[model samples]
Target: MREPLLRIEGLRTVFRIPGGEFAAVDGVDLEVPRGRTLGVVGESGCGKSVLSLSVMRLVPPPGRVAAGHVWLEGRDLLALPMEQMRQVRGSRVAMIFQEPMTSLNPVHSVGAQIVEAMRAHDPGASAAALKERAIEALRRVRIPAPERRFEEYPHQLSGGMRQRVMIAMALACSPRLLIADEPTTALDVTVQAQILDLLRELQAETGMSIILITHDLGVVAEMADEVAVMYAGRVVERAAARALFEDPQHPYTLGLLGSVPRLDEERERLLAIEGVVPPPFALPKGCRFHPRCPFAIEACRMAPPALEEIAPGHLAACIRAPVEQSVAA
Candidate 1:
């Protein structure tokens, strides 16, 4: 197997609140191998967005990375100086945020934004070359009339178009890794499928790895080569997408799978998780999910279970859940 394009080890992001510290991301370990897509799935406030921000060193002022390493192409990004980190951010790694309407500047022309992103990483490039490249990028994302749309402001474009522009800017420099945090959240179903298909096509052409953060299991099923299920602030299960869907090892994973709405099944009501995700500041002791976990036991209440390998590549962080039985049955 190829060396991982990005590897996060024991990543912990903490925020200072009124009285104490809160962990938005706690001890997360993940890897995105070159040319593979790793989908991160969880409900809201499960630390999915925080994990992405921490990896990029873009955590907000009151919050910061407390420990662990973010290794991109073997270099420890956490140790890099601010100036160097800025260079690496867009030149090597790029991100497409959740809301393009909010993320894109209202005043700037979409093309101008893309050009600025290009110039930020490559200051020596000619203005004409940058413009040409920007237009080409717009075309690559399948935006109609790249020349006309280039001069339009964010408000002038539709939601789907604005998202395409965001994607275009992120891929403008052909970064080695792209972190997409719910890139299709605000768009309609048809547009969402188009955006996802575009991402897959772009990945195939560039061989760039992607970390797709989303709460939609259907999206994960469609695009993910591997899946990581997170709850409260930690990953509860990690496995290849097929293995995860076929045989989820953790109770949370099973609950997530069970909650995915099925079109074929005739049901009186939709299945859903029992309770809400615990607040970051008030995470439960031991297993964060213990309070809501149907399979919680005394051991789960006493101490947090470390992520353990149950099969060749699958991992789960639940002490009471029987991994062997799940895989066998």
Candidate 2:
């Protein structure tokens, strides 16, 4: 088997809450093969974003990685010293945050920020070279008049354009792994499609692995080679994108799929998963999703089901996955 480009095992991150600590990311495991995209999908407040942040070692203050290893090309990122980790971040692994306005600096020109990122990785490179590379990055992301845009500030560009700039900066270093957290958030439908297409084109050219963190099933269907379905900080199901879409095992996974509007199947009402995601500090024992599971049994409320392989390359944290299918039929 080919070694994965990125591997995460038993990863846990915690936040110091007002009352106590909450495990924002709880014992999650994931991997990404080189040149493939892995979609991390879950509802809001389900720790999808935190998992990505943990991988990059950028979980905000009051939250820190509590356990597990983030392996990048056989090297353990968690064990690396601060200086080494810093070097590895923009150089080997880059992340595009959810919001561009918050991520991009208001004070600095887009060109200057990209140049700064490049310089961090390659300080020996001359200013002229960095500027040229910055323009090239913008052009690669399909920003028209790269030189003109390079001089523009973050506030000057449209939302989609700012997102492209974020992508430009993330790819400027040519990192092997790209973690995009809701990269197309808040964009109009047309802009969202354009951004997704741009990402696909760039991935094809660079062969860079991507871990897309989003709740949009449509986006996952369009981009992910594999999908990991997360709920309440745990990966409830994982499989190839096609397999997961065709045969979702976990109740939450099924509910999420049911929520998407189908083109062929006509329906009066879109399905919705009952109950909001439980607060991190108020998570229930046993299966976190038991309350919302339509087919929940006594066993579901007894104890947390371990994630087990139900088929080759497919795993789900449910004991009655087969039964659920039978019941649905």
Query: Can you give the TM-score per candidate against the true fold?
Result: 0.96, 0.97
Q: Sum up the clashes in candidate 1.
A: 0
Q: How many clashing pairs per prediction, in order? A: 0, 0
Candidate 1: which pairs clash?
none
lDDT of each: 0.91, 0.93
Clashing pairs in 2: none
Question: Which 10-residue window in model 1 sums to the lowest lDDT?
Answer: 320-329
Output the number of the lDDT-best candidate: 2
Which one wins on TM-score?
2
Estimate candidate 1's alpha-carbon lDDT, on a 0 to 1 scale: 0.91
Residue range 1-329, candidate 1, lDDT tens digits = 77788999999999999999999999999999899999999999999999999989999979999999999988999999999999888779999988999999898899999999999988999999999999999999999999999999999999899999999999988899999999998889999999999999999999999999999999999999999999988999999999998878898888887777798787776667798888998888999888888777677888989999877799989886574553455
Off by over 4 Å in 2: 324-329
lDDT of 2 by residue, 108-189 (tens): 9999999999998998999999999999999999999999999999999999999999999999888999999999977998
Candidate 2: worst-modelled 10 consecutive residues by lDDT: 320-329
